[model samples]
Each structure stands twice: as structure tokens, then as C-alpha cells.
Target: MSMAQRERQQLVEAMTAAGPEAPTLCGAWTVRDLAAHLVVRERRPDASPGIMLKPFAGYLDGVQTKTARKPFPELLEEVRTGPPWWSPLRPVDAIVNLTEMFVHHEDIRRGTPGWEPRELPAADENALWSFARRMGRRAYRRSPVTVVLATPDGKRAVVHSKPSGEVILTGKPSELLLHAFGRDEVRLETTGDPESVRAVLSLDRSV
Candidate 1:
């Protein structure tokens, strides 16, 4: 099976095991709310646009609220099976869901105390690195300090324009992905001027 598919299945399993009221890294969202968001993202494209667009934010919230009110088992089942074949998400499933599911899986796992990074396949690591390289700049565009993301083996991508000083963030690509997406709990090393390092480390905004 594809890595994305595996990640999705694992996320569904984790959410099911965590139960509905469990906390998630997503601010103020419980496990049930997170599951509903995923379901709406995949199965309800008509309501998904509001998720990222400010004007439609209320609509997205309403859709998620309605979906979250469903039986937890039924919501979990829909997320596990994924969007219907005719859904718009199918065409970009790999590009969209791979990282999305992986991150949210970690959100549930790592939000609790005692969580650790998973040992992902090498191929998945490379895939995530490639995707992060393409997406990192936009993710860090608003940073006050310039950001550079590097892998242990020397792959590197620079995000944001050069400033008076910059911070280099190095770690496994998956960890870097988490950091890029504003998960402050991710393990990463930063090197640069003290102020620049502090600025980079303090950032926790989503892309």
C-alpha cells in the first residue's frame, strides 16, 4: 500500500483508540473535532473551502460541528475509508493527504505526554523532504528571521528572504516538517545569532 494510505489508516486507528474527548495539538479541538475536520476535508469539498479562506470560516465551522455531532464510530469509519471515489480529493490524494494525515496523526499522538517520533520508511522520508522543500518557503514566509531547513545527510532548503542574520534548523525531514507546520514540540537544532535562533524557535504559526 502507498505511504499516504498507511498513514491515513494509522491516524484513524489512533483517533479511534484515543476516544472522542481526547485533546489534540490543534488548538481547542478534541479528537472528535479533529476527526470531523478530516472527514469534512475529504468528503465535503463544498464545505472545505471555508477551512482555509477567512470569509468561509464560519461555514467550515458549521459543517465541522454538524459532522462532529454524528456517532463517533460512524465518523471514524468514514475517515478510515477515505473520501468517496468521486470526491475531488482523489485527484490530489497523495499530494494533500500524505502530509496532512501524517501531521494530524502526530498531533493526536504527540499532544499527549510521552509521545515519540515514528520510524518511518526511508522512501517516505525522502518523499516528505521533497514535499517540504517545495512547500517550506510559503510556510515560513512571515517569519521575522530567515529560516534554513537541513537534513542530516546535507539536503537543505532555505525559506524566507535573507535578513541580517538567519537560523539553520536541522533534523530528520519528518521532524522538520512538523516544525515547519508550527508544532513547537518537534525536536530540532537551531544555529545562528542568539536573537535569530530565539525568533525562529518561538515561531508557531501555521503555513
Candidate 2:
């Protein structure tokens, strides 16, 4: 299988083993919900509907919104069908997907309250960095700040947000990416402020 496929495969293996009680990032979604979300979302965008957009009480969620999950077997069918939109075949989308995986893994890891952080694939990690470096400078992310990523393993990247100000952030690049991707509860040292980092991450998910 290709690197991207392998990465997704690894994610499936790790998450499938998580018990129903295991927490996923989407606020109260068990690991099962997370798997289902990934699987259902990977299908044509048309698969979901207005029910996804309806308002509700506690835990109201969009169909393919960030934290939904599905059965492990269902995700396997998506694999047999094809890759999700955010995948290597789409290059940029691949990075986007990696960011999702990394962040969501934290969701599961933290929700469980005592599990270890699952190590992401090196290539996926690198792809996310490359994409972040580029996307950070787009008209959308334009800010006068320098975002530095220092991963636990020492992977590093320096991205400057121009025209805003010189802001600096440093941490395990993956950790930063996860925090930036809205997994929540990720702690990182900041030269500017986490609010700024939080803004960037929010945009990454929303836009």
C-alpha cells in the first residue's frame, strides 16, 4: 500500500482496539463514533444531509463535523472504495487529513485519560509540516508572527506570518499541529499567546 494508505491503516489499527469507553476528541464521542465519522465522511460529500445541520441539545453535531465516528468495519469499506478527500492523492488534502488524524488521536488519547500518544507516520508528519509552512503564509493566515514547530522527536519548521507582527511559538511540531488542529487540551510554550495559536487552529478546521 501507499504511504498515505499505510498511515490511515495504522490509525484504524490503533483506534479499532480502543474500547467503546475510549474518548475521542469530538467531546464525548467514543472511539466508535470517531471511526464512523471518518468512514462516513470519506464517502461522497453527498452522503450526509440536512440532519447534519439541524440544531439540538447537548452534543448536537454535524454529520461529518469534526468528531463523529463509525464502525471499524465501515471504515474498511471506505478504504476499499477510495481515499478521503484530504489525502496524498490530493497532496494538500493529504496534509489536511494528517492534521486531522494527529489531532483526533490526541482526542482519543486524552479522553481515555491515561493512554500513550500514538506516534504518527514520519511521512505524514513531514507532509503536515510542509503544508502548514505553506498554508501559514496564505492571505488567510497572514499575521506578523513566526510560528516554530519543534516536535518531540526534534522535527522542526519555521513559518512566519507576515504583515501582522513577529510572534513566536515552539513545541513538538506534532503537538503544535495537534493543538493547532483543535484536538483541545494540548499544552505548548508560546512566545506570543495561545489565543493566537488557537485562532490559527480554528481557521484550519473551519476554513
Candidate 3:
């Protein structure tokens, strides 16, 4: 199966196991809320802009709240079924949902008790590393210092650069992906000039 498909199934399983009330790393969103958000993102194009733009946020919030009120089984089913035929996501599921599913899966896993990192296939690791490289630039685009993402396996990318100094974030591809998605519950090492390190840490790295 494709990476996106694999992660989607795993995300559905994780959500099912955790139940509706289970907490996630997405601020105050529970499993129910996260599932609703995913459903709306794929099925409700009108409110989907609210996910990224501020003016549409209220509409998105209202949609998500209403979706969340559905029976948990129904909501979970939508997430598992993938986007509808007419939805734009149907054609780009592999590209768009790959990171989306993986990060959210980790959100559920890390937010719950007794969690540990999973052993990912080499291909999946390479895909995640590419995602980190691409999204990391956007996350640190305005940083005052140069930023580098490095993995123990020697794969590295200079996502952001500045003349001031450098800050390097080192971790596995999966952990770096989590960090790029504004998640704090990741295993990573930050090493660089003191001021530069602090600056990068203080920045909001969420996607």
C-alpha cells in the first residue's frame, strides 16, 4: 500500500483504540475533535479554508463542532473511508495526506500514556525526511538565524539560512516530521549557538 494509505489505516486504528474522549497533542482536541477536523477537511471544501486563514476560522469552528456531535462511529468511519469522489483530496491523497496522517497518528500515540516510537520502513523514513525538508523551510522561513535539519543517518537539509548563526535540529526522520508539525512531543536534539538555539526553539514551528 502507499504511505498515505498505510498511515490512514493506522490512524483509524489508533483513533478507534483511544475512543472518543481520548486526548491528542492537538491542543485541547480529543480523538473525536481530531476525527471531525479530518472529515471536514476532506469533505467540506467551503470551511476548509478556515484551517489556514483567520477570517474563515469561525465558520470552520462551527462546522467542526457540528461534525464532532455526530456519533463517534460515524465520524471515525468518514476518516477511514478517505475523501469523497468529488473531493479534491481524492486525487492528491498520497501527496497531501501522507504527512497529515502520519503526524496525527503520532499526535494520538504521543498524547496517550505508555507510548513509544514505532520502527518505520526505510522507504517511509525517506519520504518523511523529504517532507521535513520541504515543510521545515516554511516553518522557519522568517527565522533570524540559519536552521539545519539533520538526521543521525547523515541526511541533512539547510531549510533556513541567515548570516547571524546556525541552529541544528537532529533526530530521526519521524521525530523531525513531528517537530515540523508544531508538535512538542518528539524526541530530538537541538545543538547550536546558544542564542540561535533559543531563537529557533521559541519560534512557532507548527504547519
Q: Highest lDDT: which candidate? A: 3
lDDT of 1 by residue, 82-191 (tens): 87999977877877788899999999999899888888878889989977766677777767877888998899888776657788889999998887787887888888
Per-residue accuracy of model 3 over 18-112 as CA lDDT, tens digit each = 99999999999999999999999999999999999999999999999999999999998999999999998899999999999999999999997
Model 3 lDDT, full chain set: 0.92
lDDT of 2 by residue, 33-118 (tens): 77666555455344433324534312334544433454456654564444555643344534345555555555666676655555
User: Which residues of candidate 1, in runs, are more than 4 Å off?
Assistant: none
> Which stretches of model 3 miss by more than 4 angstroms?
none
Candidate 3's displacement at residue 94, Å, is: 0.8
What root-mean-square deviation over C-alphas does model 1 reach?
A: 1.3
lDDT of 3 at 138: 90
How accurate locally is residue 128 in candidate 1, as Cα lDDT from 0 to 100? 92
Superior by TM-score: candidate 1 or candidate 3 = 3
Error of 1 at 197 (Å): 1.0
Error of 1 at 63 (Å): 1.3
Q: State how far residue 172 of model 2 sits from its true place (Å).
A: 2.9
Between prediction 2 and prediction 3, the one with superior TM-score is 3
